[model samples]
Target: MHDPAAPDPNDRDYPALMAPGARDLDALDARLVDCRACPRLVEWREEVGRVRRAAFRDETYWARPVPGFGPADAPLAVIGLAPAAHGGNRTGRLFTGDPTSDFLFAALHAAGLAALPHSRSRDDGQRLYGTRLVSPVHCVPPDNRPSPAERDNCRPWMARELDLLGPALRAAVVLGGFGWQALMPVLTAAGYAVPRPRPVFGHGAHTRIEGPDGPLDLIGCYHPSPRNTSTKRLTPAMATEVFRHAARLAGAGR
Candidate 1:
């Protein structure tokens, strides 16, 4: 588990930090209506909306915020970095309707970590059976890099989501170094201990977490972002192996 004394994840005063963000709230919806917190993302999305207009003008771009996806409650929590600006930023579902999702869900399917392999978009109607995708930053961060402030603004909601699914959260797959760093603090706060052996984040790093309710295992992987797999930093077969362990921790498969 991580200590509360660890440096605050975000730079804001704790209470003034932004509210919870589960992709299913009225207040969150309103604040996100015109959020200028990150100027870069706002500019990019607006540019996308403008240049990509024509037939796409009237279509709701989900430009506001992309919330967490997957079963609200599930056996595993897979955390990624911020939503890719053009990817989830356009679709409103994390890890959905993108190239990254194609590779990711395929591995999860083959490994039996997910119920299905196709995640075209939120309305594609595909659903996860026992797995969920929760990003530390609920919305897309510009350049795929969330400032410390934006990440901090979003942690409370991540914590809130963990509270909702923690009981069933037998395992977690943190994709990429940033996502892995984001999870450490909350895991510690929940009485989950970072492994003494210092489980390093990699394609298949594994550690144990002692939660308030019980113990859960932690796994790390390179983010399924095309930036990684396309560069060979992460491979589909390797990703499958990581999920295989996560599934086993959840008692889902052999």
Candidate 2:
């Protein structure tokens, strides 16, 4: 069923696959939009776009990979699991147009990292002062779960993101266990030495790893999913506390 003459979207060589002269943030985003490495993710994202969710019937879904949000040189970063089907997949921005985003922005605002307390669309004018948000997998996976192979396949993108962020990246707040697990290796590959026993993820877990730039502080926070929030697994205060600590570590006082 595969066409031999066509270019493979899963091509492993990043530099060769990217457009000529595509070196900046906008160019990197364009390259991300063209990724179709995972067959299942590609089909599901496109199908979700075509069918459209009931509430978003009048709106067009992004349907493609969602790139990291905020400036490339931000001092702190928040890493999430993956794009939500009706959230990032709909707004083309991480944590936008969803209840999870509402909770997240509120916490970030309280931590003094965000200018606003909500994000509805990409053009909402909400801005992050010293933070960025990215995901381990860029695509909206089926059933909100990406296969192990899929996550590994997307590592190159994450690696490039970490590289672009450069030495300015001082602290990272990992949301939930998935983000924690996904980021450990990325950090290790980026020349950071992970702990010997490996750090466990908890609501307010914290660890320090040596990064290419300098000592990178890693903080953990439970994801603000509806299930977690409704059940009180992840409270607003708890999430805000983790970010506040991260801000302090990054020397970006709130």
Candidate 3:
């Protein structure tokens, strides 16, 4: 049972409790790492940290909320659904130490965005140039699915991140339908004029949303999960092309 004195995750103002004075990404991230708002997520993350996956049994698990990776003032952002259970949840960095990262970072490197072709650990010497990676949900969910309430509970973090990134963020490549849907509202709330009826999600789909400073380009791409790649629904070449397009839109391309 949750302590009666503990803050309620369901409360609409729950985010305030996490970081009331956070005026920058670093402060926000520090607060995010300490969040224990959702009991289910908190329990699951810690359990995974303790119960050791066979391949990673010798390694210590980060087992906490994963934060966005890359420079604070990046021009382009790659938005994903959530952290992979054994990937980001273990490494404490988005898209690290998993097959999904293997596919995605290789593509990012091909597009001149990432310094390394693979993301395996927090200290992997990997770097992103003018690009940042973020997600709607920071924690890994059971079966890779976060409930609606959990999504909502985590929305504020994304919103705050976007708010801080607004000055430099010019374009975004959203991976999968879930990220596309989740980001639309956040964009709208961030002062972007998302189209009425909203744009549909599809691979290579592109739209320009007018923001207070200028237009922010949105591009859709298939998630780089093994399932999609194995089925040929998304290929390395396809993912690379999407990042290249987003880079050009954000003026970050080589």
Best by TM-score, which number? 3
Predictions in order: lDDT: 0.71, 0.85, 0.88
| Residue pairs in clash, model 1 | 1-188, 1-192, 1-193, 1-194, 2-188, 97-120
Candidate 3 per-residue lDDT over residues 120-179, each given as its tens digit: 999989999999898998888888888888887788888888878876889999999999
lDDT of 2: 0.85
- Worst lDDT run of 10 residues, candidate 2, spans 12-21
What are the models' TM-scores? 0.80, 0.92, 0.93
lDDT winner, 2 or 3: 3
- Alpha-carbon error at 244 in model 3, in Å? 0.4
TM-score of 1: 0.80
Could you tell me how far off, in angstroms, the CA of residue 94 lies in candidate 1 after the best superposition?
A: 0.7
Query: Model 2: what TM-score?
Result: 0.92
What number of clashing residue pairs does each candidate have, in the order they appear?
A: 6, 0, 0
What ordering of candidates by TM-score runs from best to worst? Answer: 3, 2, 1
